[model samples]
Target: MSDRAETSERTTMAPRASELGDFLRARRAALRPEDVGLTPYGERRRVPGLRREELCLLAGVSVTHYTRLEQGRGTRVSREVLTAIARALRLDEDEISHLMDLAAPARRPAQPRPEHAGDSARQLINAMAQVPALILDRRNDVLAWNGLGHALLGGHLDPGDPDLPAHRPNLTRMLFLEEHMRDLYGEHWPEEATLAVASLRLTAGRNPDDRRLAELVGRLAVQSGEFAERWARHPVRTCTSGTKRMDHPVVGRLELAFETLQIPKSPGQRLIAYSAAPGSPSERALRDLLPQGRPDAEERPRAVLSAVASRG
Candidate 1:
């Protein structure tokens, strides 16, 4: 089978309602009336979480207005209103950004595609030498990867295919669809997968009109019941740096620190680098494997040109 495999049909579902409403509804359901210091006189509640009236009151908005907003009636909304609701919901910086994105007056425009991983970014990854690095677009599609990255995450697949958009390896997709990726996380698979979904939720909210992104979502939702269930939860989070626990079949267990660096030249692209702490056992293991991967490709550190041009 070819690497970077995709479903043959590549189906897309009918677009759901403005995600603004869905987001509000989901978040609202995740809290309880008492959680926000409200009492219902011990009366049985009809719905989960706080009632719409309760939330509106807490958000300092009228019942009718809040109801309308949740019903997808906003052609435009004030930042003040959004801020108020975000405060009432106790949203974090990442969640607040997602809220604002969902509640924006209108989507600016669809991103035709994200920028390529330029030469500088590729060289940066190469220069890191010991670091396993991969550049990914906003949609979580791998744009470029150094040899260590390819070996660390996807040794069984073709490393070059991700440089080409038509067959790019979407990290989230691989986590769910490819058995190898799921196994790599071992005991941490659930946490890793949840983070991926949550991060994607924030990205989707921010770029609702990106057609390719929407297609990816629809495809994942259709193919993986696990993905569909998680996506419906509407989890949101922003993560720049984190630690990962991975079990490589060849390298054994690895505890690595990862940093996600945004590419300034490519608005929607980010270069993620992974390394174990210096002098640590994980670092030694990484060193042992760094030279083990296939680095036979002549263009080892070449830039990832735009997806259209890079494809075979």
Candidate 2:
């Protein structure tokens, strides 16, 4: 199969409002009447969670209004209404933001604009000899990576692949489609995969018309049953920093704390850098993976030039 896999036949080119409805339904189904202090009578409930009537009662909206919203009808969806519904559902801050994104009017579909790591970003990653760092677009495409970053995360792939748009390594695809990534996470694979899906859902809400992203999501959904199931749950969240446990082939078991630094000029581009705690086994393992000496700008891969060129 080609790298840009065709979207599954079952996947529809549905409107964003449809997504909003799906999210609401999923969240509503997951919420119990008892969650919001609504006493359930001693009887078998016909459906899971709170019924529409109960939810609307709690949200302070008429059943008709709530039903219309859940049905994705063309009624004016006000922020106040969403806030009320969000409160009724007990959504967290990230979920609240995701709800707003899904409810926003869809933008006109456009061609996928090329994304690349700028020279400054490349230089920044290269300078971090001890830290494993890589630049990623909103779609989780690896635009560029320092030697240590490539060695630590994707030693199985071609080192120069990230420089070419067509061949660039996407972290999301690797997590689900590639066995090496799954092996790296080992016991923590489920947590890692869930977080990846949740992060992608957040991005999808923000850029509903991003065709490439849609393609990525559809391909994963069709190819990986695990991904399809989690996606159906409508998980949404923002993850800026976290700890990753990995069973590296060369460095053995390592626990690394990671941080994401957003590039202001490139809206969705961010530099993800990983570091181990001081005087720890992970630090020593990380140091073993680093190159003998800091690589100067001249030593950086030629792939970066191709990436920079592709941006224009």
What candidate 2 gets wrong by more than 4 Å, as runs, is 1-12, 292-300, 303-312
| Model 1: residue 181 alpha-carbon error in angstroms | 0.7
- Give the TM-score comparing model 1 with the true structure, all chains together: 0.89
C-alpha lDDT (0 to 100) for residue 283 of candidate 1? 93
Tens-digit lDDT track of model 2 for 24-94 = 99999998988999999899998898899989999998898778778878456899999999999999999
The 10-residue segment of model 1 with minimum total lDDT is 2-11
Q: Point out where model 1 deviates above 4 Å.
A: 1-17, 108-115, 293-312
Top lDDT: which candidate number? 2
Local distance difference test, each candidate? 0.79, 0.85
Q: Record all residue pairs in model 2 with backbone atoms less than 3 Å apart, i.e. clashing.
A: none
Query: Per-residue lDDT tens digits of candidate 1, residues 103-127?
Result: 7655544558445677788777767
